[model samples]
Target chain A: MANNLNTRKAKQKTLTVLKFVFLFIYLVVVMFPFLWMLTTSFKPSSEINGPVDYIPNNPTMENYINMLVKGNFGKYMLNSLISSTFAAAVATFCGILAGYVISRFNFRMKTPVYLLFMITQMIPSFIMLAPLYQMLSKAGMTNSLGTLAILYANMTIPFSVVTMSGFYAGVSNSIEEAAWIDGCGYVRALFSVIVPLLLPGIAATAIFAFMNSWNELFMAVMFVDMDKFKTITVGLNSLILKYNIKWGEMAAGTVLALVPTMFLFGFAQKYMIEGLTAGSVKG
Target chain B: MKSNKRLGQRRNIFIFCMLLPAILLPLIFTYYPLIKGGVMAFQNYTLMDIKNVSWCGFDNFANILSNEAGVDFGQIAKNTVIWVVVSLALQFTLGFALSLMLKKKFKGAGLYQGLIFFPYAVSGFLIGIMWRWMFNGSNGVINDLLMNLGLIETNVGWLAQKETALLSCMIANVWYGIPFFTIMITAALRGVAPELYEAADMDGASKIQQFFNVTVPSIKSVLLMTVLMRVIWIFNFPDLIYSMTSGGPANSSQIITSYMMTLVYSMDYGKASAVGLMVIAFLAIFTLVYMGATKYTSED
Candidate 1:
């Protein structure tokens, strides 16, 4: 009996070692690319060509300079920043107010409208891809960054509503009823009572909108033209196509594209989990 | 009292009017695009040269189906299936396991959750580029690391080679997708009643046994919904394909979206829209199946 217990303890210890080993390896697997991208961003031109040579004997910042200075990184970043941020802000504003109405209203067609908004999220983005490109192009809205913002806002509002509606459901109706009885109108109650309660939900919805627009490549790739209008995804993609084998510059540009979301995610780390999980698990 | 009721009715109408913008946007932007695509599929159009238009009917699709017409779209369709299924299986399996790990309280659990979900926030295009760099043939990190470790005798050109290309794409895709399941499943796990586990424990059931009997059933609703949504997403999105390989190594990994993009860019509008139509058809069928299954399962 003593021997069996001792052996079991030893086995458990071995399991701990194996479990940690697995985790460590998985971390390496995930983080390896990020590390490599960083390394590749500084590699000299000669060493950038091969399969097994991401590192350079003589590292340089020349590639980074070339990418930003020559490749319009500032313009691209600014374009993405302006368009995506605009989209997020506009979507959040309308989405929250509308989500509140849908949640609290006893109007006709409420369920259908909500269902329509829900289904919008599930439609293959590709089905809309060509047509949106066509229609927007015809409208002459494709060229402007504002057009991109509108497109982004349109894509994100469904998701924003679905998640935000769920959140408003959680934000007790009694509070709003109290405000209603105090001679506050529905709009005033929504603005003063319900809106404040939905701060966390709005934050999550904003993040989702921002992330969608930031990561958006299809719209960016299809519509935008000229150097000044290229968002980061399209810009980096075009950079790679035009300058194949320019490893450092490509890496630098890609990393630059990654920064905003990385910053946002880091700041609001807690809500990313709750916001994504809530609607996701529920739906 | 009569005036108050009238006021209430008026308020409801006003509330709905406020929802008009949200409603109108999707109607125009979302559904209109789909309707446009439905029509556009029938016309030979390159907006760049819209003057030289012709009606192709279903000729684009027919050519692909007949194969003698030499479009080779059958290959693209086959690749789309492979991309979706392979990704779905891997993400579900790994995500399930990761969620299982997170079910237990641990030191730095928050940090672990944060790290795991970080990939989901990383842009798909960047994931494509990051993987492309890692899979770089001669001087890439994967080869370098493997060579240094003395694990492999030769450098493997992961994304560049036909055989390895789709699998390499899957590696990055799986990374991006796993976090989604983990987040959803973990949330489900939180909602799972501890009473079920307690009862199972009283029966002297093993931990693994309790997991299967209690945990699985409890999270089944969440599992069903998340899986449905995920299946739809992976089937539709070919973004990784666009960025990673661009349907390269002889179009071996050309999912439908990438194929459609190539055709459209080259002004084969009739064929591209036909391909786009095929994707919509698939999605429509898939959504029907998903909703049917959800309704069916939930009923029982």
Candidate 2:
């Protein structure tokens, strides 16, 4: 018995060590690109095309300055921010309303409406691109940030609804009922009581919507042609298409564009997991 | 009794009002465009000559399928299959393994989880650009590292060649996608009961056996759903391919969706819409079959 236990312990130790080694390697593979991007962003134009240097010897902010001033990245960043914020706000609000109704109320059209939203999740935005472009161009709405925001909101609505509904499902209705007994109206009770409780879930859903809008390249590239209207994705993409690719400035712009999403990810990671798993596994 | 009836009617009105924006958005944005695109698919609706637009009666579809279009439809179909299958299989397998390892709590697990899941937040286009530079023929980190490791003596033009362009994009797709499965499977794994594992252990089952029996069955629904969702998303995803290769080097990297994108760029709305319809048809069929298979298996 003693010998068996000793061998088992040794085996467990080896397994633990092996697991760590595997995880470490995976981590390196996953993070190496970001690290490389980071290092490359700080390097001067000369060092970027010169011998492969893992780290920048003279880490300068010249690339960032050039990208901001010359590349119109600042304008692109602003456009991205305005559009994504509007998209997130619209999506989250509509999601909250739709999610609440679906979760709390069962009207005659309940199942059909739910299925409609679910089916939309399967439809790729690419399919709608041609017609949407035509419609926007005909209406002279192409190259407009407001138009872009609306499109982004529309794109995010289905997933946002599903996610918010998952969250609403998790919250018991008893609390809302109790608030109602205390003379809180439905809208007021939702705003004051349930909304507070679902704040994290709402944050997660909004962050997701924001990230989707921010990252969208296809629509931004297609619907908007003007330099002033371009998003960060379009700007960075155009930089690559130039005859002489500016690797340093391209890397800097990418790093800069990643900041908001990365910052949001740090805060909303737990909520996002809950929201996504709840949306998928439960639904 | 009359007042109560009135109250119920009022509540119904409120509900309807709450759902109006949700209903209107999808109707206008999704269904209307879908219908319009469907019509445009059969018409000679190229943006270059909208005044001459007329119904072409499947001409666009025929041209594409018959290789009359500039792109090779057959090669594109094959590329799409390889891209989806290889990327999906590797991502699923590796992601599942990573999730299993991360299941048990250990020192610095949170930090490790954060680092691994970081890619999920990054944009697909940005990932493509990052990988594009990394796979650059000259002065790329990949070539540099490979040479240092003595794996290859000279630099290889990954994106410049038709053979390797799609493969390189697939590599990026795999890397970008693994985190999604990890995030999802890890969440599902947490919901599995420890008692089931204990029972399997008591039965003298090996770890692998226990995993197959207890863990698999418990998380099967989540697994099935995640895979289905991922499949749809991957089918839709052309951003990476677009930014990485732009479906270039003789259109070797072009998937069906990205092909549609190129058509849109050329202002060939008719052909683009036709290709878009093909994507929808493919996805619809795939989803139906997937659902049927999963349902049949679950029933069994």
- Candidate lDDT scores, in order, read 0.79, 0.89
Question: What lDDT tens digits, residue by residue, belong to model 2 across residues A1-283?
Answer: 9999999999999999998888889889999999899999999988988889998999999999999998889999999999999999999999999899888998999988988887787776666888888788889999899999999998899888888989999999999999999998889989999999999899999999999899888888888999999999889878978878889998999999898889998888888878987866654
| Candidate 2 B-chain TM-score | 0.96
Per-prediction DockQ scores?
Answer: 0.58, 0.66
Q: TM-score (0 to 1) for chain A, all models?
A: 0.88, 0.95
Give the clashing pairs for model 2. none
Candidate achieving the largest lDDT: 2
Q: Give candidate 2's iRMS in Å, 1 decimal.
A: 2.2
lDDT of 2 at A230: 96
